[model samples]
Target: MNLTSSIRSAFTPQGALRASINLGNPILACRDADGAARGVSVDLATRFAALLGVELELVVVDAAGKSVDVVVSEQADIGFFAIDPLRGEHIAFTAAYVLIEGCYLVRDDSSLRANEEVDAAAHRVVVGKGSAYDLYLTRTLQQARIVRSPTSPTVVDTFIEQGADVAAGVRQQLEADAHRIGGLRLLGERFMVIGQAMGTPKSRGEDAAAFLAQFIEEMKASGFVDEALARHGIEGASVAPAA
Candidate 1:
């Protein structure tokens, strides 16, 4: 479907599509060895801009919460985010384009052997402030004490420094940390699977959101998203199903 002029204006009042790229979610967006923003989310946003026939201006932020704030405040026209009810209040989300596993990482010798064993009164879980995992765990974890790290990438370091029992974050991030540092192991089962999607501020209106949603569905149906993931060498992330 062609993008209506009005919908296009709503999405990009500044003539360029300002896309918020969250650097915190490595599987979605991250800096390369050369310090360039390169990841599945960046590639997807570039494709969306091309489809709109507009220039793509990436607004890079280090955390998911900041990414949402930029879009909601109209500092950016759109952003990539993990779908969560808390974020839904401020932004209109497309059907998820990727599914990222969320799991706990603990020291190799820790007694927690499975995902189900994470929530206990004695366990202290460290999560990035305002992250998808933090929001989900806050609402669901009844027994464990949750601590906030400064950012998602710092969760593992924070866990080790604070002596927290578990570090909760994107599984890919934890896996990389496990390989880089010694004595870290992820639980065999995933506690949550974050649905990553493109979003615009709710102020952008339903028609604009709907237009973007259709674009996302088309990309998924045509395997654009899957191809982008492979091209970026993203692993442990799968293309989300059609809406």
Candidate 2:
């Protein structure tokens, strides 16, 4: 894939490729011991910048909504996010490069043993504010109430603090929280499969969008995504099928 000047200019209007990285989702991006950003999404951002022959400037944020805002407002040239229809209005997303399970966590003593039992009048589901699960549940769960934490990493803590009936988020995050907090267990099944993908502002144009889409496909087919996940020690999420 040759980089056209137009595409390069579209992605580097600020003279460098600024990528918005959301630290909310541990499976995609996170801070290392030195507080530097390092994860699967960071690897892809670096590779994409190298391909464009530009410097990489990371616009690191702590929440998914903030990452989306950065890209949609063109403050960053690109971002990593879960594929969702509401976000699509302002952004053009590539086909997903990873598939993550969205699961529910509840106190072990609770009677909610199945995913189907969650959407009842008496249950209160807590999720990360503006996360993929938040958007999905807001649209789908009619009977249960939804509570939001400030960020994905805080979902479980907020759930416990608020005494919410359930906490919803990435399976890995929920599992880790369950282990760390104790007395919590995940439902037997996942509520959703989140498709994680790269996106750019729609103002970047169709050519830029197409180039990014092709780049993601190449990354997946070439096993770059898989290797990055393993390098980051990311588990529970699988590489998305080629689009």
Per-residue accuracy of model 2 over 109-211 as CA lDDT, tens digit each: 9998999999999999999999999999999999999999999999999999999999999999999999999999999998899999999999999999999
TM-score of each: 0.97, 0.99
RMSD each, Å: 1.0, 0.6
* Tens-digit lDDT track of model 1 for 37-149: 99888888898888888999999999988998899899999999999998999899999999999999999989989877888999999999989999999999999999999
Worst 10 residues of 1 by lDDT: 1-10
Off by over 4 Å in 2: none
What residue pairs are clashing in model 1?
Answer: none
Best by TM-score: 2
Each candidate structure's count of clashing pairs: 0, 0
